[model samples]
Target chain A: MRNLFFFIYRFRAFLIFLSLEVLCVFMLVRYNTYQGAAIFNSATTYVGYVLEFQSSVKDYFRLASINNTLATENAALRAELMKYKDIEQTDSLNKMTDSLYVVTDSAKALPYILHAARVINNSIRRTNNYLTLSVGSEAGVRPEMGVITPGGIVGRVKTVGKRYSTVTSILHSQMLVSAKIKRDNTSGTIRWTGGDYRTALLDFVPLHIKPAIGDTVVTSGYSTVFPEGVMIGTISSVEREPDKSFYTIEVKLAVDFAQLSYVYVVEDPHREEREKLERDAGIKSDEP
Target chain B: MNRKFGFINIVQFVLFVSFQILFMDSLILYSTAFCFIYVGFLLFLPLGISRVWILLLGFITGFTVDVFYDTMGIHAAASVLLTYLRPHILNLLTPRDGYDTSDTATIYAMGWRWFLAYAVILILMHHAAVFFLEVISFRDVWYTLLKIVTSTIYTCLVMVIIQLLFFSGKRANR
Candidate 1:
């Protein structure tokens, strides 16, 4: 007993370190559990309230840009209505009208594919850029959901709360988004090169695949995180080496990440079902 | 004599937290206000404060900030680390026997250079721990070192500027 006590006393700091390490490990292991995630949900709402008040003052400067966006959207809606009218005679008029009516009626169009949120807190200088959004889990946000603005794809949802969510911007090195060339079906993964926020590197495209500058890239829909057809960026440059098997393409993001503020969180209705299937498949494969 | 500063500390916490959540959050050009509060609280604790109190303060400050940022317990863990390190930092700089209870570690008590060194070291340590914790928080080690260095430098610079401005008022009065 004396020897044991002496041993513990000799390394008191080590024991403390061990205990703390254990606690941290426990917390980390239990992190994804519902209780741990719910805490962030509540905190985000509180933080959102504080940021909402602060942005209300600075929001004036954005009035002009927001007005321009609204005007453009309004004109596009009008054009869409005209196009529908021209095709109304040829197609099933009532079915087309039902689809068009939802968007044409301004009241129902308030919350569409993209939801607006004020940026409460944002960090860009860090290699892993994270932006705090005013919207949260209570607002229908979930982890792995894609966040975007009028400009382009911003990032993916890292965590969500009742009234706020943290978005990992495309500028982050960890952001791996699948994108495809607009002109051709060739697709590759997009990741930031850590050199410029305005540009990203597209990897895994074969050298045989032809790609051109100024070609648009959109989400490939492989991951349920983002819906198909969301704009990613345009190809700014392409590099091919004789020995290398893959062509590396440089993409200039469509969204001006530096000026990002308001954004939307996209929810994939099939995510839960998809995840369940993947998990079950893995378990069955391991059973043999 | 009553240790009347409890309410004052709470008020400071509220004000600093409010500043972080509101004004500093949206401003990507500068560091967030929570960084200031983290350093500010460290400066406010009286000389010879107990270790437990320091740990408690660190945990609360960090947990609250994490709650806002949606980072879970990362800030809390980092804050606790800062709190544990502050006394050691003070010990390293102003040896306990040499410190005067009435004089805080502000610029007035310690020269600008010493204050700068003190605040810079603490802020760097805090930011480094936070960046690493965040990286490990999700189990993704990719670009961990890069994130640590960049965020630490940015957070440290912002912290230094904020300390200079906020503590200068006290020095000016002195």
Candidate 2:
């Protein structure tokens, strides 16, 4: 025992350094993985509170722009409401003239639910950026739910807290959003090449599709996370690689990430049903 | 380790950690370089303190910053390595009269040339470890290296200005 103690004392500095560094690296690897990301992200209590406080202070500076956005959205909704009201009034008038006539399907207009959230902390410089929002599990936010703005798709929920949630922003290299060309409906995947936040790479698009520059790209609904037809970006450039079969396409993202302050968490009602059908189909195919 | 100096060290630790998280952290200059001045606290530990205790102090300071940065342990890992290497580095630069432990390891006490070399070396090691782990991929090796270099220079500049502002060699000799 004395020998062991002496040995440790002799090499105490190197030993201590090794252990501490090992512990730190261990924490880095453990938290950087997909599973334990929730506990270490900024959505935790103290940092959450501080960032929320800072955002609240900054939120006051941008109230005018926020109000403008709200007013524009309200105007669009009101216009749509007027059109719907005209149709409903016409239907009701016809129903009064002929008894037993009924109006159906208005209650099921949307397949997903949207919850409004304020982004408390946002980072755009990192290759894999994330945003912390004031909404969380208590607000019905959950992992894998799609997050978007009034303008375009944002990202998916990575981890949820009681009062906050972290979103793996679209700028992340690992993020793969199912995207399609609005004109031709040709599908591709949106990926970041770790350089530009305003631009992203569209993968798996064929050379023959011939997407014109400025073509609109939107979510294709292949993944249950995002409902179909949400705007992603507009094509900025396209190139056909001689060595590869697919076209190299670039997209200019619609949402200005630097100014991102508000988002809507999208809850897909039929996501579980769709995933279950796919799983059961896979099992049946495996039986052969 | 007189009780008075120990108490002063405790106060410095809190001040350094708070400065790092509150001020340095919020400055993301050009979206690449992040100046971390807290590492200066580890480098300037009272002379003759046990190397093991220095490592622990570095971890504690780094962990305080990490909790706010949400970087898990990247800062702590780099800090431990830098703190453990400080003694050997001082020995490498030992003057014939040897290190005067009377004054704290302030830039003013250590002379501008010696202190600049020391600060630059330690800051480079810390920044390299931090940015390498931060990017975590060799695919963008040049970019990560650029970030490391810029952040190190930025940190060293901040340390020099801080030392000139508050601490002076004449005062440290007391």
Candidate 3:
């Protein structure tokens, strides 16, 4: 600071002259009738002309904090939405609670528990495609729980880790779900030949059912893998082989695999007990 | 011991400021040329006054004229600039015999030729700064320049006449 004073003193006359000149310039612009407006107009345009400048400035500075807060809120909202969504998608028939009827059926209206998770990694190009999720063992997501999007069925939980989980997406060649035609209750197995994301193959529907285009196919609830009435898609096209009695079904998939963002893990807490009882009773059904 | 020179300097500073603001400000010629005899105060400052004091005195004198003329800092800025340039002008006009600090810068003391050159240069630079700042644009630079030159000569003429009337015989010749 002392050095600054010395340096200033050395050039004091010129510095003083320069300062006075600057002061004069400022006053001239500030008070001059003609130039004042011109100067301010130019200055405002040069500095303030950027559209959304106020929001950009505020957003730029607080973006990180805002992002973190929004992320947390979104997580909470998604979890709540997924819970309600699980209730919305599950068959109202299966969730029935009537005290008048004695409990006699094994599939007795088991409540579905839902946990929201985001797709961390996914593949639709492979013959055997798998979807990775953000939730893992820490989120109570285990192997074999069904994962689904808001549109329709996604896949079953294949594996679980502390930080993430993988779902076998329905687009995989090996993935097959027991699905039924809502129009006639004709049950069939839905599969993917593994090329397109929009269509899946529905096999084993008998020719007598006469399924039409745009008929919604839903889960048959024949297996414990998925609950009844979860939408798979609609029948897009039907073809018949010259020798076969079954219809070759092409289903327009409801869930767009290419644009998948979030999925929910559907949990039935009584699934293990019911499967154990079924095994003990030797009531084995086609497991696929 | 030279109370006479100090008293004349004060009188010159006050009278030059008042006369320039009162009579000269309204004396605008050609909508561009303006009389700016306030520069005469800076011109009459004692030779070899430290550049800092010269600049300060210049700013004060011009600021005084600015208050009356309502030109804000225009006169002050020009005055300060001319004040800093004074030493170079004096050095350029210095005779081969060198300058006598005690002699002062009146025409009688320094000779009419040296005094005119010194005063004219300072007045020209001051007028140039003042008018250019007042207009604050270069759109009519040639016209502004004409005003600067004309005002410079008019200021020099007034200063020289003042010098003749104020300084003569014994004191300047001493």
Candidate 4:
């Protein structure tokens, strides 16, 4: 007993260190799996509601721009109505209404993102930055949806509440967005360099991809977090090494985070069904 | 007597943890605030406190910061290590029996040189461990090393500033 106590006392610090590290590793491993993912879902929804309430006050200022966008969309809709009438005058009225209703309902079924949120709690200064949006689950905000401003991609939903949701911004070091260059078919990953909020680094593009400065970068839609063809940023600079395999590209962000007042969260109504099918097919969704 | 200090220390721990998670954490300016306050905790440890309590305090301090940051157990691991090493540091600076029982470890009790030496070593160790674990999450060895050095420098500077601001006063001799 004396020898055992002596041995333990001599290495107590080491034992504590080992035990704590092991505990942390265990927690980290557990958190990375699906079991813990659902645990955050409820808390996220409650927090989202609170965040949305806080943001509504700031979002009032962006009403003019949002109104103008809605007005423009209305005018475009009217023009399309006229074009449809001219193209299909001989169709039966009942059939026309049914078809038109189906198309509109189907568009709505695509999960029309309705709420515009203002960022009240923003964190562009961290290695893993999270943005708080003022819209919540009560306003139809859900987890795994995409949030973007007219400027560009903001981030995807991490947690949702009745009135607010938290977004993991693209500026985070852990955030990875599937992006492709406009001029070429080649694609790569976009990740932040852990310092600048207005720029990101593109990785994995091959030397043969032929990228240049001013090339537009857009979402590749390889992941469900965002739809295909959404603008991400533009390549501001490119550094090609004499003996390297990939070009180091610097991208200028499209969103003016400093001036940001409002944003739209995109919701895919078919997300659950699509996810189920994908999982059944042994495919995993790339989420950050 | 120790129990009374323990209650005050718990309050301090909670305050620092809350400030780190809810306020400074929101600023997102590199999460430097937590790193700053962590040094402050080390500085505030009363002279003659048991070695086990020091390590335990360090563990709690680090674990609190980690829970909010969502980095799992990295802070806790580093903090426990810091606590484990604190006694060795205290021994180097002041003989075990030389320090006043009621006197706090302040810049006034130990000269600026000893205080700075102790603070720098502990802060660097904490920062190095944190950055290494965080960077290694993705398996980038060289990148992690660069982060360790740079972040350690930043954390060390902030720790020094915090020490200068809060713990510089001399306590009455016991």
Candidate 5:
């Protein structure tokens, strides 16, 4: 017994090192996977507060660009509103004489609800990138909700805190977005292989379909997270490798991840119902 | 081994960690070279500190940085490896008269040549571990290699500059 104690004492440093390394690796593997809630992420209260403070300080420098994007988005929204106003006037005139029409819940008619949030912290250089948002459960942001900017899709919320949330950015290696070509409707998956933040690879695009450069890729809406027809990016390059069945297409992402400040979190109201129904039907659902 | 954790060391720890997660986290050069200045704090710890304490401190520091970086344990794993190898590297590069109890692993204390070799090897190992563990695959070997090499050089350059600017050669106890 004394001999064993001596042995342990002699190599205590190595033993400690091994155990700590094992613990770290355990945490790495455990938290690395897409799970319900993460404790050590930036969305934690203190870390979120610090990051929010830092972003608040840095935000001053980006006010000009933020204002520019906001103005452009406002103009686009105003034009869209004008078109909708004319449609509403004609529709209401027709419906005014029709007293037999049954009233329906407008909220139920809308499949998705958007919540605006400010990005407090973001990183693009890591293998798995994540963004911290200023809104969380308090603002109806929850896990698995898709995040998007006016330019394009950003990512999906991974975890949520009281007043903060963390998003798994589209730039993450493990993150895959179901996308389709806007022109021919050829469907594939968009994944970011490390190296460049502005680009990602669209896999499973069969070689039979001739995808040209500048072809727009948008969400397929096959998943419950992102709504269909949201812009992802344009195909910059398509390579037909020898013996490969699919063309390796590169997409230039629309949103500039580096300058991201404001984003909208999309919440699918009917996601649980659809998912439960699919689960009951024994159909496997794809991750967001 | 007998030295205690000073108030200055605690302050330095907080400063190093905060600076890393806040300022240095965003400062990436050319998209490939990342400046992990927090490694400097781990690298320049007092030589007299025990290996066990060093290892624990490394884990704590890396874990703290990991939280803000949202990488969970990658930083901690790399840092523990770095601290584990620190003593061995010091033994390998021992000076003629050996190290003083008050000596720090700084450029001023150890000279530019020794400091460079020490910093490069340790930083290279840490970066390799971090980048490889991050990707968890050998798929993008060339790009990962480029990142490790560039980040090592970038981190080493920054550490050296920080050492020169902040850490002076004069030891008050001596």
Candidate 6:
């Protein structure tokens, strides 16, 4: 017994080192799983407050550009709203407002809810990138909800605190967005393989589709995370390796991740119902 | 260490950690080289501090940095490895007359040559561990290697400049 105690005492430092390292690895694996709520992330109250304060101080320099972007977006939205209003007026003049039409329109209006939030912290240089937003559970932000800028799709909420949340950015290695070529509607998975923050790879695009450079890519809405037709990016390069059956296409992302300030967290109201129905029907629901 | 030195070390720890997360976190050069100046705090700890204490400090420091970076354990793992190897690295670079009991691992106390060797070796190990652990694969080995080399150079240059500007003056007064 004394020999055992001596052995342990002699190697206490090594033992401590090993145990600490193991604990870190365990945390890494545990917290990295999709949608897992981690207690120690940047969204924690104190860290979020510090980051919020720092970004607030830095936001003064970005005010002009942010104003310009918001102005342009407002102009675009006004034009879209005008078009919709004209259509509504024409429909009313035609007297085609049936009960079924009203039902469908109301159903469509409630599919997704948007909450505007400011990005307090964002990182694109890391292999697995994440963004911390200034809105969280108190503001109705929840894990698995989609986040998007006015320009393009951003990422999904991974964890939420009282007034803060962390998003697994589209640049993350494990993140997969179901996207389709806007021209042909051919669908594939978008994955970022590190290095460049501005680009990602669109996988499983078959050879016959013949995708070209500058072809717009948008979310396929195959999953409940994003609404149909949200902009992702445009294809920049397409290559066909001899051994592979799929085309390796690179996409230049639309939203500049580095300059992200304001975004909308998208919550699908029918996600639970759809998921439950699919689950009961024995459908796998693979896309996320 | 005296109470004054202990208090100074505590202050330095806070400064290093805050500076790292607030300023250095976003200060990447050319989207490739990252300056992790917090490692400087670990590298300059008093030589005679217990290894167990050093290990705990390393874990705490790295874990704190990790929390802000949103990489929960990668920093902690790399930092623990760095602290675990610090004593051996110091032993390997022991000067001809051996280390003074009062010595801290500052460039002002150790000569430039010794300090450079020590810093480069330990920082290289730390960066390699961090980048590889982050990537978790051999697919992008070359790119990861480039990041490791560039970040090591970047961190070492910053650490040296900080030592020259701050620690050198303090040592002269002593």
DockQ list for all candidates? 0.21, 0.60, 0.17, 0.34, 0.83, 0.84
Descending-DockQ candidate ranking: 6, 5, 2, 4, 1, 3
What DockQ number belongs to candidate 2?
0.60
Residues B65-160, candidate 4: write the lDDT tens digits. 654454556677788778777878878877456775555655666667877788778877877777766654666566556656666666666656
TM per model? 0.75, 0.88, 0.42, 0.75, 0.95, 0.96
lDDT of 2 by residue, A27-95 (tens): 888765654235756777677787798788777989898888878878998999999989997775656
Deviation from native of the Cα of residue A43 in model 6, angstroms: 0.9
> Deviation in angstroms for A158 in model 1?
4.2
lDDT of 6 by residue, B52-135 (tens): 899999999999999999998999999999999998998898889887765678777777898999999999999999999898
lDDT of 3 by residue, A11-123 (tens): 87778778777876776555432321112211123212221233244346656755665576589889999998898788476557763555676456557888987664554
What is the Cα-based lDDT of residue A94 in candidate 2? 59
lDDT of 1 at A80: 92
In candidate 1, stretches whose alpha carbon ends up further than 4 angstroms from where it belongs are A1-37, A41-43, A89-122, A131-143, A158-160, A163-168, A193-195, A241-244, A268-288, B1-5, B25-37, B95-97, B134-174
Candidate 5 residues A1-288, lDDT tens each? 999999999998899999999999999898877566658788888889999999999999989999999999999999999999889987766567755655495435866789999999999888899999999787888898999998999999998888899999998989999999999999999999887899999999998899999999999988888988999999999999999999999999999999999999998888888788888998856655
lDDT of 5: 0.89
Write the number of the candidate with greater DockQ, choosing between 2 and 6: 6
Local distance difference test, candidate 6: 0.90
Rate residue B122 of model 6 by lDDT.
95
What value does the TM-score of chain B take for model 5?
Answer: 0.94
i-RMS, every candidate?
Answer: 4.3, 2.2, 26.0, 4.0, 0.9, 0.8
Q: In terms of DockQ, which candidate is strongest?
A: 6
List clashing residue pairs in candidate 6.
none
**Candidate 4 — which residues are off by over 4 angstroms?**
A1-13, A32-111, A114-121, A132-143, A159-166, A182-186, A204-210, A242-246, A256-263, A281-288, B1-8, B22-35, B137-174
Q: For model 6, how does the per-residue alpha-carbon lDDT over A171-247 read when each residue is reduced to its tens digit?
A: 99889999999999999999999988999999999988889999999999888889899999999999999999999
- Angstrom error of the Cα, residue A216, model 6: value is 0.8
Q: Identify the superior model by lDDT, candidate 3 or candidate 6.
A: 6
